[model samples]
Target: MTTTFESAAKNIIGAGNRLDTLGLAPATAGNYSMRLADGSIAITVSGAHKGLLEKKDIMRVDASGQPLEDKKPSAETLLHTVLYEQYPEANAILHSHSVPLVVLTNYHSREKFYHLEGYELLKVFPGIKTHDVRVSVPVFDNTQDMEDLGEQVRAVLKDRPASSAFMIRAHGLYGWGRTMNEAAQVVEALEVLLSCELETLKLKKR
Candidate 1:
């Protein structure tokens, strides 16, 4: 079912609050969006603190990311739009910056993907039936050029059609799903996996 702008805004606000409380969306570090009923996107405005988001902080943008409202969207708005265009089933998308993801990605800078295996939380992602499998989450270098970055992301998605989330080196993670709740679940699960990886690395060092 298509969601109205009002409904999308409410969901976005609630999502922001939850993520912020969990320390995922710190300060103004993340952005949240929902694909509205008419195909326009309801996204958080630029520079708004995710934890303190209000209805006025949510603005509309077309599928191609042209602003339909006066408010400016996030600097990485293109990333969210491109994800929606590439994944038709995704209705809600979230980008979050967490300490574990930031540290883990930087600690493994040479790797193009973060691999999670033997994790019970792996079942939270689509199509995974058990904890025996490995999930490779793509990692891309951070860049200010959205067009180039978007192209790189699309190429990766084309190859890995089942990937549910990706990370930006030294930056954050982008996750999405068919619903806002599902999207949050994916992000939360990914965060926990990254946290576990970090803890394991610390144990190895000790």
Candidate 2:
């Protein structure tokens, strides 16, 4: 079913509040978006705190990331746009700066991807029926240039079509799904897994 801009905006706002409650968004540290009925995208505006997002905080943009309205779009809008381009079924994208993501990405040393396996939560992601499945979440170096970062992400994802999410080293996580609810679920599930991994490492060190 197609969603209107008003409905999409409400969804984005509600998602922001929910993520904020989970401590995933802090100090305007995240952005949210949803695909509208008209093929255009409704995304959070730049500098609007996700925790306090309002209808005005959501704005329309073309598939190419050009703003359809007067509001300025998020700087990382290209990242969301690239996902939409790659996954035609994805209607919502959520990016969050959480402690678990930052700590885990910074703590890891030798890997390009962090693997999450053997957890029942692994099934929270799409297509996985059992915990035996392994999921790799790619970690890319953080960059100030969103364009360059977007290009890097697009290149990395070119062949790994099954990837549902990724992380920016010392930064945050990006998760997407077919709908806002699904997207939110993925983000929450990944965050929980990351936290578990971090706690496991702490116990190992002890």
Candidate 3:
């Protein structure tokens, strides 16, 4: 378990560096986690800039998001925990705050979902054999109440395909994968897809 925690922590730190370089985790705005061998999760503690994350910044929480130690977990701890519970095979989860997702989600404030279809980049997600179809990314309302927010997320994601990314209106996005590398890939792909959608909106307005 100790080794699992250490390895997960290092992977998170590396992911933070990559995400930081892409301007995904600005300030202290995102959280990341990996499911440990013992069924607990190693997550980034609250208030640390992801770009500067160290192994010490990672802490443990149960599968239900209960803190295992004195250190505080991210406010979105429940969010990550829920994903783990929802998908037993998903070992890693990421929540990134990027401008493109925020802007695009808010731009379609009344719309409950964002559609990214017919793009070759759609292949970036798993099970996408081709770009001939559209994938709907859920856009949820944001709130300070974590539990309330979590329930909302649960409902929205319940019927859709499991483990694809979901967004919070004017907030950010959450994605999970079987491994840290795949989770990071999901984040990067969604980030770029959101940016492309936002750019298209600008073009349509012209």
> Which prediction has the highest lDDT against the true structure?
1
Worst 10 residues of 2 by lDDT: 103-112
Instruction: Give a tens-digit lDDT track for model 1, residues 79-165.
Output: 999899888899999999999998988889899988999999999999999999999999999999999999999999977767779
- Cα lDDT tens digits, model 3, 12-129, are 9999999999999999999999999999999999999999998889999988899999999999999898777777778888889988888877778798888888988888788887
Q: Which candidate is the best by TM-score?
A: 1
The total of clashing pairs for model 2 equals 0
Which runs in model 2 stand beyond 4 Å of their true positions? none
Count of backbone clashes, every candidate in sequence: 0, 0, 0
TM-score of 2: 0.97
lDDT of 2 by residue, 59-149 (tens): 9999999999998999999999998888888999999898878888888855789899899999988888999988998889988898998
- Per-model TM-score on C-alpha atoms: 0.98, 0.97, 0.96
Q: What order do you get sorting by lDDT, best first?
A: 1, 2, 3
